[model samples]
Structures are given as C-alpha cells and as structure tokens.
Target: MLTQTVFRSEDLPVADRFDAWCEIMGRVYAPMKMTSEFAADFRAHLRCIPLGEVTVYPTTFQQTTFRRTPRLIRQSDPEAYHLSVLLDGEGGTAWDGHEAAYRPLDLHIVSTSLPHETWSGRLPATIVGVEIPRAALPLPCGRADRAIGRQMSGREGVGALLTQFLTHVAADVGSYRPDDAPRLGTVLTDLVAALFAHNLAAEPLLPPEAHRRTLLLRIQRFIHHSLTEGDLTPSRVAAAMHLSRSYLHRLFQQEGITVAGYIRRLRLEAARRDLADPAQHCIPIHAIAARWGYPRAADFTRAFRATYGMPPIEYRRDGVRRQPC
Candidate 1:
C-alpha cells in the first residue's frame, strides 16, 4: 500500500522550486535532465498516488522539456514504463527514431530503460501518468516497447473508459484506503491491458477478468436504459448483447440474482418511486405500473406490498402524509 504524497512548486521560492522539483521527479520517476524556459516562472503541483503495485502521478507543470540521456538512464532507473495522458496543452515524445505528438486526451508511453525526450508547447501542461513494472503487464516487453513514443487516444472506446476511470480515481482518492490498494492495482492492470488489446486488435489476449468486467458494466447500463420496456427479459437482453442465455444467468449469479430477477427488481423499484411521487398522484396506479413495464395492476400491487409492507395507494397516502408540509 502506498500513501498519497503531494508536491507543489508554488510552495517554494522561485529560486528553489525548479531544483526541488527535479529532485522529487528523480525519485518519483527516474533520473533525467530537465530543461524548461519557463523555469523562472515555474508553478506546478503533483499528486503521487500509489495503487498497491503501481504509482500514478496526476501532475501539472509549466512549459518544460525533459530528456532521459544515456548517462542518466543508468543512475537510478526503475525499469518501468510511464503511461502519460495529456489533459491539457500539446506535448511531443520521441524515442528510438520515432516521435509522436500528444494533444488533449492523447496518451503515449515512455520506457525508463530507453533514452527519450518529451516537451510541452503551451502554458500549463497537465497530465495523468501511471508507472508500471514491465512484468506486471502480462505482455511481452518487446512488443509493448514498439508502442513507446507512439501517440494513442484517450477519447473513445477503452481509452475513453480509462481516462474516465483515472479521473474518477483522482477525484475520489480521499475515500480510498490502504486495504484497497491491491484491488485498485488489479483494476489498473486490467484497464491497461484491455486498452492495449483494443489498440492492437488483440482482444483474445485480454485477461478474462477484464472481459468479464466489461460485459457486466455493459449489461448493467443496458438494464438501466431498458427498464420501461414492457417486453424486456433475460432472453431478449442476452440476444441484444449477443450473449448466451446461460452465460447471462451465470454472470448475474455472481450478483446473487438471476438476470430476469434483476430486471424485475429494477422495474419494481421504478414503479415504487412513481407511486410515491405526489406529482404522479393524478396518474392512475395502473398507469404508473404500466409505465414501469408492469401492465397488470394486480401483479404490481402484489409485488409492491410484498416488498414495502403495504398496498400502493395506501403506501402513497401514508408516505405523503408523513412528509412535513
């Protein structure tokens, strides 16, 4: 487990901020020579978050250029790969005779073992990065290395999902605990591998856990969208998503319910909300039930009473009366 560390260059005197930043950067990433025309005007902040086995840095810096020289590579290399996602400004990374440009929502990787250069052109350049040990990726290093300095996008597909995930993690970091580290690390690995798999057209190479997670999220989203469709059922959902009925049931089994049961529960919950809403009072109880896919008022009332301990009309009057004002 890794505790979060924050560093802000604004906390230092203008004369000391640059050197202090270099010192911290050396430890967090790797030893490197950094040059920035805006160093005299330097202002930066970084969140060093450790997710069990990997470290992520949500960083912002003014115009800067960084180089990993051969001499610097041997000093204190972590032998890890840095996956950088540019959140602002334009940046470029070059290594092994290849160069890639990164704009907002673009991502690329850099290998600490190889000499490379990255530079920013705009004002404050904000980026989120994860440093992972080569062995943790489940991919051959050589194949992965080819992607170094090659710009990829974080705007759609798995890339978009990853960017959202990272941003969410950064925003919710305060709620995370030490015990959550290993699971968080696993999530990071799965997302990264899935991204690479999608990019390289190697979906079969993705970890089983990643595929399972992707399917579950997609299914839940579909359930939420189809809640009001009267004909929605496990068989129909499976057909729409191109999954076997048995497989869909097995997936929902992990959630302690059959797929059909899950859909029914969602429909019932929606019906209950409508029933309790004063604005919905003018609407007939049968209409509200049909609105949530419960065409039969008797069936809806039975389920509602079983769950909430009262009939729909009685519960609505009681609930509304209990409200002050």
Candidate 2:
C-alpha cells in the first residue's frame, strides 16, 4: 500500500481540527486524547503515507501541547515498532520508571506495548515517524528501548547518516516510487539500529551482518556526495574511504550489486530528477546528462533508455506535458 494524505493548518477550522486529528491518530495508536486548546490553533503542516509494509507520518507541530499513552497492556500488533525522529523543540518521556529527555535530531523508539507519556512543550516542533514490523529491526527489543529520549546529535557517525536520510525522504515525499519504499524502509531500520548500538556502547552486541551492512551504508553515502565529480570511480571511492578496491567490491557483491552498476544507477536517478523539473525544461538533455557525469549525448541516451524504459527527450517531453493547469 502506497497511500498518502497531506494536512495543512490553514485548511481547517479551529473547532473541527481535533476531530481530524483523532481520525489520523486512531489509525496508528489504539487510544489517545486531544485537548480542545491543543486542537484549536495547534497548526499542523504534515503528511502521512503508507509505504509498502510500513507507514510513515511526517509532521511539523506549531506551538502545541499533547500527550499519548498506550491503551492496552500489549499492542494490537506486537510485531511492529514505532520510531520517532525529533526535528525540533524539546520533549520528555517516562517509561518503565525511567525518564529521558529529547532534543532536535534525536530518535526515539518506543514499543507499542509500553505505557509511556510524551509531551512537546510550547515551542514549535517537527517530527517524522515510521511504523515498522519488529521482524524488520535487527536489534533486540530490550537494548533498543534503552535508547528512547536520549539525545543523539546529527553531526557525527551513523547519527549524521540517519538524519540525512530522514531529511531527504521528507523533502522529496512526492517523488518516491512504489518499488523504492521497501528498500528505503530497510535503510531506515538499519540506521536506527546503528544509532542505538552506538549510543549503548554495545558495538559488539550487534550481529556481524549488521556491522557489514552499516559499513556499506557509509560507503554509499560517500559515493552519493561525490557523484558529480568525473574522478568518482571505484579507485577514488576506495582511497577516499581508506578501503581497498577488492574489499569494496566484496562488500557490494555481498549485497548482490556491483560498484559500477551502483554508480550508473545513481547517475541515472539524478538525470531523471532533472528531466522532470519544469525549470530545466529549456536545458538540453545532453547538458543535463553531462551534469550528472554522462559526457556524451549518445551514451547518456543509451543509458537513460536502458534504465528508464524511454529516451531522455521523450521522458522530458512527457513530463512537461503532464504539468498541472
């Protein structure tokens, strides 16, 4: 399922707003309450989408107050995990006789079964939440819960990577494809687990498979940042990351993909983005391709057709013709 809904504060009346929220919250939480004051003028600029097997709701709260507690001893679906990434403001949680604080970019994972209270203060705030099945997470539930409400800075290591991933996904919500949801979900799960593992000082607690997966993620990030450079090759990527080319190749092989193939796919993805842009409608297809590393027009066309099922010119023309009136 790939259903999405967008809500803007300016679109609804103050009196009817709380009812709207209840409809949305009911889909995720079993029992929750909304205050009248919290509902009126508690502006929410948000979107919710069902991405594959998971559901993601990205919300920006404007100076509001609310609290949520589980309605049952156990969640209706024990198999699911609720992960929250704090984008702004301050909040706190008290669960299992433990209290913790949260700041911007901090991720909190709470079991659906836990009885916890979360409060966002008077300041405006934004959060992106993902609901994933328990089987999807590679970490133990006990250790994972221990990370809730603890601050994790988005400037270093896996925290930075996870922050970037969430930021990008939220920014480009309309561009994602049905096929990209599951893979994106996996990345979200892995990054959350990596961040939790780093915080617990329990690197050894993670399975070996997770360690290798995280390593490849770091490598992929490096490649994505350096994609525009002509020198961004296997050798350059290896040297920049201080890994041997053979080792890099082996890592990709484990994932059943090749380094060169990955590079090509990234390049094609970038080109597709440009082709669909109305601002770039006047730019020649060859120029767009060259900007993404395909220097020759013929080569760019061949690669674009092979990857996208159509030539660059046709894709761009179709994209422009479909613009809203």
| Least well predicted 10-residue stretch by lDDT in candidate 2 | 29-38
Q: List the residue pairs that clash in candidate 1.
A: none
Per-model TM-score on C-alpha atoms: 0.60, 0.55
Model 1 worst lDDT run, 10 consecutive residues: 202-211
Model 2, stretches more than 4 Å misplaced?
Answer: 1-3, 63-70, 73-79, 202-325
Every candidate's lDDT: 0.80, 0.72
Compared with the true structure, what per-residue lDDT tens digits does model 2 show for residues 122-170?
Answer: 4667888878776676888777776764555676788789878877787
Q: How badly does each model clash, as a count of residue pairs?
A: 0, 0
Show where candidate 1 strays beyond 4 Å. 202-325
For model 2, the local distance difference test gives 0.72
lDDT of 1 by residue, 1-325 (tens): 3478999998888779888888888888898889865465478899999887788889999767789999888776788888878898766766777555666898878889999987776368899989888889877888777667544679988889889888878777877888887788889888887777666663234356445644675676567678888889998999999999999999989869888788887788778767666667889989989988889989999988998889999988896897668
